[model samples]
Target: MMDARHDHPKLVLPPPTYPAVLFVMAWVLDQHLIPPFIDSVSSAPLLGAILVILGLGAAGWAVLRFMRAGTHVEPHKPTLAMVMDGPFRFSRNPIYASFFALFAGVGMIMKLEWTIVFLPILWLCLRLWVIAPEEAFLSSRFGSEYEHYRQKVRRWL
Candidate 1:
């Protein structure tokens, strides 16, 4: 049976809040939690800083790839074509996944246990709010083609 929720399109913007929230949370944790924890774990501030930069670079690359793929038919709307090449081939939502990974990498480098604690929260937010809706929209729009792609590729590998 068709789920009624599928009748409506997915909310794409709100899902992005997870990353923003994580960013703020990471900052807070770094300022507060990491210092206290630093007594037990040796600090690698330099290495951590490097990882944060690298992670941002990776996430930026994914975003650039998405923009270069195509111009949207509607200026403010989603692109019509399914981008299956580049980073998209590895993960359906490379941008979002990359952001998540970047957050994780940043948290790890900063040694913020509290930020790490929010990783699962970020994942849950993406899964329930963003991914679920995007999946529904794509499935509704592409049907079997999307199903085939979903079957072949992991959501965020």
Candidate 2:
């Protein structure tokens, strides 16, 4: 049998770091280079608040599930178990989904148009650099179980 730790996912960086860097860049652009997309949208803050709450809740839940499963939450570390409960039941990448939600929510609340604009780019980077490699590792390590989970759960929802 292969050592799962030795076969951990080859990731560019910690997954959260991608969104953090993108968010900072977006905030800087919004403050200095670009103006708010809307002069004032009364609903933006409310919507942002809702998204932020949901995102944090989902992320926390996923982390707890990881802990219960005794699996390494960090992508670069070895995965000891396949978590299928909690938010994982809905989306394979719930934590990542939460990150996007949190990023967009903060942007909306702050009226940062650049942050919204960078969303697609942020998603593409995550997909290519983070999720893809992780998926490959999971498929290799978990085999059919991971494939079945992948088929059942959408990448993002």
Candidate 3:
């Protein structure tokens, strides 16, 4: 099949790609926006590290669940089944939640105030451009089964 992403190239960035591109943007922003922190880093640097690890773990688990279900992990493709086990027990979008957590963790650990500032734009893009389409696709493909699961699980925890 022709790739679904080809149709809306500008709007539909995959969630995993966001941090890679935006981290560089955040670094550039940090250079012009603030003096390097001469002060010592905070305790939450460790907490931030933990969050990054946890976020990756969660995303990985969600992907594993999709693989186990024989469902396509990429939302652009039609999924074979609705995955409700693993991390899906809590959030409808564990992978996206992981992205948010990872982004926040990086900002906190790097002490880049501007990262936090632009975080919401990244979030809006993910929700509107990325996840929204995926959710709509699932709703259409899976119908009532997907909707009932959506009602049970919050989007993010």
Listed in order, each prediction's TM-score against the native is: 0.73, 0.94, 0.84
Give residue 110's error in model 3 in angstroms: 2.7
Give the per-residue lDDT digits (tens) of candidate 2, residues 1-157: 6675566898878888888899899888878886776556888878888989999999999999999999889877777889999999889999999988898888888887776788898899899999999999889889999999999999998
Provide the overall lDDT of each model, using Cα atoms, as 2-decimal numbers. 0.67, 0.87, 0.77
Candidate 3 on 29-69: residue-level lDDT in tens?
Answer: 78886764622666657767888899999999999999999
Best by TM-score: 2
lDDT of 3: 0.77
Q: For residues 1-36, could you state the per-residue lDDT of candidate 1 as single tens digits?
A: 445444445565665577787878777866865664
In candidate 3, which residue pairs get closer than 3 Å at backbone N, Cα or C atoms, i.e. clash? none
**All candidates: CA RMSD (Å):** 5.0, 1.4, 3.4
> Weakest 10 consecutive residues, lDDT, candidate 2?
1-10
Model 1: ten consecutive residues of lowest lDDT: 71-80
Stretches of candidate 3 exceeding 4 Å from the true structure:
1-11, 36-41
Give me the runs in candidate 2 sitting further than 4 Å from their true place. Answer: none
Is candidate 1 or 2 superior in lDDT?
2
Model 3: worst 10 consecutive residues (lDDT sum) = 2-11
Prediction 2 global C-alpha lDDT: 0.87
